[model samples]
Target: MSDSPHQMTPPPPEDEVSGWLRDRRGHFDQLVSSVEDYAIFMMSREGIILDWNRGAERLKGYTAPEIVGRHFSVFYSDEDRQSKFPDKELEIASAEGRFTVEGWRYRKDGTQFWASVTITAIRSESSAVEGFLKITRDLTEHRATDEMLRRSEERFRLLLESVQDYAIFMLDPEGHVMSWNNGARRIKLYEENEIVGRHFSIFYPPEAISIGMPGSLLAKALKDGRVEDEGWRVRKDGTRFWGNVVLTALHDSKGELRGFAKITRDLSDRQQVEHLRETGRRKDAFLATLAHELRNPLAPMLPGVDLLLHAPHDVATVTGIASMLKRQVDQMAHLIDDLLDMSRITAGKIALRHTVLPVREVVDTAVEASNPLIREFGHRLTLNLQDELMIEADPYRISQIISNLLSNAAKYTPPEGEIALTVSEKPGPMLEIRVTDNGIGIPKALQHSVFELFDQGASGSSGGLGIGLTLVRTLVEMHGGSIALFSAGEGQGCEFTVRLPVITTSAPAATGETPVIPSAPRSGPARILIADDGRNAADILGLFFQMEGMETAVAYDGEEAVKIAANFEPDFAFLDLGMPKLDGYEAARRIRRMYPRVILAALSGWGAEDDRRRSAEAGFDVHLLKPAKPDDLREVLRQHG
Candidate 1:
């Protein structure tokens, strides 16, 4: 460094060079040069490098012989040079005695590196600037790490700011607010500026704070890493809300406690629901409700169990019966299980599995589930398919909807009444289904509340758990549809119209079972014809009854069965209504003429009052929904006696 008006050690003798650099043994240079991590050198006051040490050579990729006496501006980037920044450093150092900066600098290879450079002005004893001492350190790696950390922190900040639901923030070791997020601001009703650095206990109610809740929570989190609580949290406006809070301990990699992270969620709606249930609703008398709910699932199962016990050991027959019973039982279970999913529905959590399916398949499946109830009422179900169409919907929920409506109709309808299910396309892309029943209809006054929770009907005949219609309406709406009820007056007829969205989906109109018209002529007429659509259902049942002794003739379609009965003249006749050529109804009517005193049992899918009346009119002494059970065969003898 050349001496300037400023002095390096007040400038040595005027004629002699400064001893700082003019060392006889080169010891001063050796010490500076040995430090490879720093570039230590001297520069003339005019900004030209006068000497370069080993550290400078190593850091700038130039040897002393190659770089000595070169202008220091050569190491500065083009932008810095264009702005005269290198000269400015010299000027600032000349005037202020020292200048320091961290910026981009270049090496001998022209590659850029972050450099911390300091320039110190040296002056002669006469107060004239002579030279300068400069030092440079490579900080590229350190700068890179700092930049990466800065970006990560920025992203974390943005993520917290964007959240709007959960109140998330940070606390200091003593529970003072360290940071606040957008969610925290919204939920706690506190601005970031107003809340940060404040004690977290302020958010707690006076009682809670008096009890040391905030301090205790911090302690628990410090010990356990996390603590959770559901309690009242006071907001900025002094209003209180039910909140679910989680306090988690934050720690460094060294296992030292840093602070805490708090997350709060508003749960006031849930608390309000609990309060309403406590105050407005009363469900203390629950025994009858429990019985009704349990009875729903048991209706289709008990008969099957009784039959299987007394059934003969025919593998194929037993397998068929078991499989059928299992399917019916599974349907009942699935439907009843849906009724228990009200909690999920109310919580906005029930999801539907939508699929393109045939309307006939859906209708048949729902009817299968409601068969027991329909038969119990003896209602004649008439299905009218005005339009064979395909529908897009959640098959399970749709089945539940239709089954509920059918079950309700069966429960309220009178014996020997009529129930009809009609499917057609509406004006738009909607599939309309109407379930009409001529039974105990809803009174005009109670019709509006029928779909309300637990409002079954005015009559005691609408026997059920009373959640069916409510469930049906909810399920119907979930499929992007609506359900409506209509009835003229009591004892008239009730109708439910459900309109559902119909997507342009391709599917065969009828992929379900083919309806059978009564017809009988087996491979060989053995004086008996047993007809059942189920594979081996009739054969297995007939074989089982035969092993019990007595000449019990298993009949097919009512009269097709009667034709065989004419030749066989069996005293006991078991007839299925869905026979070919002649149904069990007509067969029974025909057979009763031939043998007036014969014991006849009508095998029906359901036994409604109307069904029993029709069977009796057809001359059947007894009718059973589950005709496969031993109870039915035994019931035949019991009725005869």
Candidate 2:
């Protein structure tokens, strides 16, 4: 293999190079003239048209022979020509090497359209300005599209600004406020100047801001395209209001992060209205419960009074009727007392009478009170008492709390179920009482609300006012104790634990139980007035009073009672609280004015503390719930006579 030297060719001569350049210019001209999108042409340094291509003919609507030597200024509108814009374009291109702009251009037919033009000044070998190469593109359609887009954006901006209920605004990709609208000002209580450029977290609560919630929301929106949330938001004045917000991420055609669009609505007023409606529903439920509880005691009293009146000679029957009446009266009083106690508890008007007592004593009293129910349900009671375990608490309320819990367990549990009450002293000077039952357990969803008033569980088939647990919790808390309930869902049974702080003190002296007093003997025939809206209630009660050695006069309404009392000159008057024409309060005031010494009493279904206070204010000596017992009446008469 012989290594031979590479040979190099010599450069072309000047004459051959000039010929090649000329051929290339011809080819470039042909290519430019073939294009139809842009008008390619040439203008002399004097602003005269030198050459025109097919594109120029198509764009300017002129043939080569008709427009070749014409002034290039003819392509401009008359006003542009008058302003010498065409001449100025040449001067700028000559001085700066090129001039490019978009402006109006004229066609051969006297019509005008938008165009983009570029003029490049050609220079000779001597650096002298030669002809100019001008290229123009008809941009009329593009201009029309741009105008439509501009109008659309204007309309969108106006729509957002006009909204009053929604805070429509914009934020940067970094969660900074960008633009504010009228609705934003109205809802957020900040002016555009004050809010723009600030972090969007300003609208969030302090707690939410501290947790970087606003930034998290922005990131979520960017990932998910949109995010919606409802929560508390702060206004410019620092007042809190509920807000419903939607955040939508904005992006460009290239998928570049632009910003976000945030729309917020103030829902505080709507939330308040919904709350009030819920309260109204609870009130309606309570009223229905009140009606049901009242009728329970009244149902049995009706026939007991009838038997006593129609069979007075049957001592055995009379005694049975008297006992039944007494039991029913006590039941009614208990129902009324529960209602009043709940009211006082809710109003924070109840006071606890604290005393040192052994927990065994409280447990014994509660077990005694609940023994009947336990036996009725056939439940086996188990007691785990720590001997001498003591606490300083309200003895009566504590006993009531324990009794209610035991009673609840008995009622909810099936027959032959087991109930255990355990009392123990825990550390920290705390006394714990746990009541457990193998009963129908509360549902998981309702366990949290079991202590709420009027909340009834699925096991509430046994009749109750639904306030037992409410009272239990209220009384336990009043004694500086806490109560908690646990259940393993439905049918898994339940356990309630109560913990109270214990104190070191000597146990109080135990008082003797008061003896039940016997009913007094009816002295002599005494006049009485009875007023009630319910005819059955008034007639039955009047018959019993008449049988008890009292002259009874009946009236169905307050007005009738007042008229009857004036004529009868009754020594005692009973007025119903709710009656037509006149109410019990007014009737009592009028009757007391007429007969200053009459022992006035109120008879009504309502037995709230306020009812009693109103009765006293209206001159009633005593307030009695409806279906009053004959023995209670005889006792009152015995005292007055």
Candidate 3:
């Protein structure tokens, strides 16, 4: 009873509103629960989960019942747990109001995922510590995508560095080079350090820069997304070369202009090749025309010379005329043959009638051809050979090549000097043919161009065109052989060596039956058609045929021949392969069509294999090279006519 006074009565309730307090707290919890993209939860003072929402369940693969009572540390990966990141996060939150981090987290199944976590400390109204609340979002997919994109970009950069043949690089919008590839380095002869940051205009020639072509191209690319050009461009050394250039503008994500990608290719070599081809084609055409025009008249001259030789006259006068005719005709024939040979070689018409023949036979044939020329030059030729050395080659071409070499020796050698010709078996599958002359040697400067068409060196003589060596090279190479020219120096003598492959032997006879020289023609009148481009040639041919007791009609060009042949129905027709309106080949085709049975002979300066094939296809019965001797012409005509 004494202490009863000390018992205090229950104090009156302070001004408090219970229902509103509960309502506000419930609204805060509902706000946390409504966050669908973040794993929002509340933890107790002991780091245990106090509340879990749908966001937490969806992110961590757990329900409220499974995770609400669990310690918050369960969300940390093993490495994070060992490092005590969960406690550290709580400590930081307790001291600094909140702790936020992006790191790997774990699910209920223990698989890890990237998480963005924000932690906050909950405190009592009196400032007593309560628990931490954490919000986390799964960012694994987004982070993985970012990492993959980084790797892809690195790979693209590497790929650009490895390319060659194209100068692939980037330029800034202002036309400054920004990137360099290996191709750019090689073509510009500059390293990346030296080239990058330089203006792209530096690659253009000064003339191009004066015209603003470089800047203009950049502006075009920026406006139209791409620009292309080709012309002479300058290199680092100031040498100009042909270049093919392309520029493409780059853009950012929002389509704002970024930079340009430029590519350049060098084409100087291609330009040179096309130029040479054009030149060669023109020269071939001109020579072919000249030969046809010049040879058509010679055709009639041969027959006329034959008639004079047979006519009743003083033996001395007839002999004199005959000798003169033979000499002039021989010269003309040689010139025509040279022209035709060049044409045939260029047209790829020469056919190889390959035969296995003794190397000595070829030498002998070449020696005979060069004997007259050698005698004229007062040059001594020493012929040396190994017996029965056989080679597989076109006899005509090999003989022609050897003959050309011997003639060259005779033409260039000093009078009374010695020329040595040797045929020997070379080691391993080749027959070595060597012709060394004590003559005016080729200049060292001219050696490189010696084999080129029409390349002539200064021999102090001007009568011959410089085509023999070229023809020799062509024929030799066509036979899969090679030729080399050597000399001590100019005026010190020149030597040519030809090496040709040897075939397994069982060679042809050393000497074959001599070609049956055509007998003199019967004394009878015959009809003839003469086609030529030169008027003098046509008249000369007409006179010759008339003296031979043969009626001849002349046509100045191929077209006229076709017309005259159709009307006159001549038994013998000589059609020049090269004519003004219609070429000889075409005219031959037309005449053959009209008179299938008439003997069609092709007289051309071009006597290449391709020429022969085309003439044959066009129904020419015989292909005669220009400047043919009168007797030879008769032989060709008699066989075909």
Candidate 4:
């Protein structure tokens, strides 16, 4: 050992270390000064700016000499300076070793820019705070883009909340409901707490769920980006509604499934409107057929009447002609009655006269009414009656319903076919009437729709107005009963079953006496006025009243009727609703003001419930449809009399 401790080549002097650090600092300064995108500067521990780079000078529009020794708070906005944010930032940086924030800053020219800033504390070897290294970047454009995106999202959310017609919602990847909007609540009748986190399939009907339609729709949306469908959906209350649905698949930037956006609109009203349009078209067709049907009977009646008028007065010849005329007239009347019944049913104007009646009587009446047609078709008929069965029903309408079914069977069945009508009592206090025929049957497609208006079976070759079954269904429903039809297909026999609630009460007392309508006393010849737009109709009606021992006046228009009534002071007036020159409504009002005691009656082709309401409002006591039978007019006269 040459000398004392083997000295490591005397440790580098402290001066040398200091020189090396200074050189590194110079290099860092050069590196930072060269950058133009970010402003780099130095601040004293007191928040006073000391050094500024080229980037800082360019961004703040201040030269190094102009900014040096200035307070760094000059770069902050006035509000931030008032709040002492610059000092707080420096204090926080010194204590925590660093502070970063983004906010508004001012340039030398007083202009503003959004800025991202970072302040890092410098420390001495003794761990004492020395100064701060500050880095800032102008981010006005990025801030603007972010603000625009935030506002756009807010607008979309508001739009979804405000919508009332369409249900807009989101679903998770597995079809769980994620979000629901106001419209979703309105349409689907579900609150967010009740629906969210549940499966989206809750909106599907049982039939749709059975077929996995909700999952299928999701899959289709995922595969095709979007899917649209129109079908029936169930509400929270389990009532079904027609819905127009659209499902759109959502994806991340990588094209992976994120979820789905579902939009649903209730289309029940639109569907109803379309149904009405379809019904109108069918009604037009039915009307055309009705014209032909009316002509069919009228054609024969005209020739037969001509023959009777010109032929010899032989007893056999007169009797045969009279029978033929009666048959044709009866046929025409039957057709007209059916048309009127359908109209009344559609207008909700048919009032049922309900009573407890024996089922046997109902069956017998229907059978008797249908006998002529059954014989004409040569069908073998069978009847099985449960004599103990009684139902609270509109006896006439019940008989009509059964007669319609029987007639339908006779018309569809081939000659010599077999038909059976059976009555049975079920345990639910219900009575069932089944009518079956070995005839050309309804197609399977039509079985469900056979009760709809103008829905004729495929095998319905026998011409008809196609309203009989509709009327039957309506009448059955009015009695709180239901009717169902079953058929395998065309050429297979069909069965129609009707079920009605049974009444436990005894049958009503029967009275063979007919009702006698009391007529007005003929103090003198009763004065009457007839108003109609149809000249011939007015004259003929007037003549009929005259023949019935009444003084009558005829007017061609409502205005003329009012004028005539001003002088005639008639005891009764029949006003047509659709006469030219001031309609019957106005005419009646005027006549009522002048002669309040006159018995007013409305005679018009318009026979709807609304029509009757208008007539009553116009002071009419009676409303009769056009082509009123003589007996109906006589009955009205008798009541008023």
Best by lDDT: 4
lDDT of 3 by residue, 1-641 (tens): 12121111121122321232223334446577656688887666567775666678778988666665668888777787899978888889998889999888888898889999999877766665566678899999998998899999889888878878878999988989899988888788888999889898899877788999988998899889899998988878888878888899999999988889998988789878976885586457546645654565467667767767677486775777667666556756665677677876777766788777777777778788778878988888888888867777777778888888888888788788899988888776787889998788888877777676655555532234567888998888887889998987888898999987755477574555445332224355667888889787777778877887788899999888888888887777778777899988888778877766667778776566666888898888788776445676677565654
Q: Estimate each model's TM-score.
A: 0.41, 0.55, 0.47, 0.59
lDDT values for all models: 0.75, 0.82, 0.76, 0.83
Give the per-residue lDDT of model 4 (tens digit) for 1-641. Answer: 01112110121233333333333445456567657788887666677665667778889888776776678999887888899989999999999999999989999999999999999987777777767789999999999999999999999999999999999999999999999999999988999999999999999988889999999999999999999999999899989889999999999999889999999999999999998998898778777878888888888788887887888687788789878876676677778788888878867888876677787888889999899889998999999887887777788888999999999999999999999998888777788889999899877766867787876667542657888899998888888889999988888988999988755567665655555332244568879999999998899899999989999999999999999999998888988889899888899999989887788889877666677888998899889877766777898788776
Of candidate 4, the 10-residue stretch with the lowest lDDT total is 1-10
| TM value for model 1 | 0.41
For model 3, name the residue pairs that clash: 297-537, 300-541, 304-544, 333-627, 340-605, 344-608, 349-609, 349-610, 350-609, 577-584
Measured on C-alpha atoms, candidate 3 has an lDDT of 0.76
Using lDDT as the yardstick, the better of models 1 and 4 is 4
281-390 in candidate 1: lDDT tens per residue?
Answer: 42321335546656765775677667767776767767877776766655454444544565457666677866777777888899998987788778899988854578
Give lDDT: candidate 1, residue 336: 46
**2 or 3, greater by TM-score:** 2
Clashes of 4: 1
> Which of 1 and 4 is ahead in TM-score?
4
Q: What is the lDDT of candidate 4?
A: 0.83
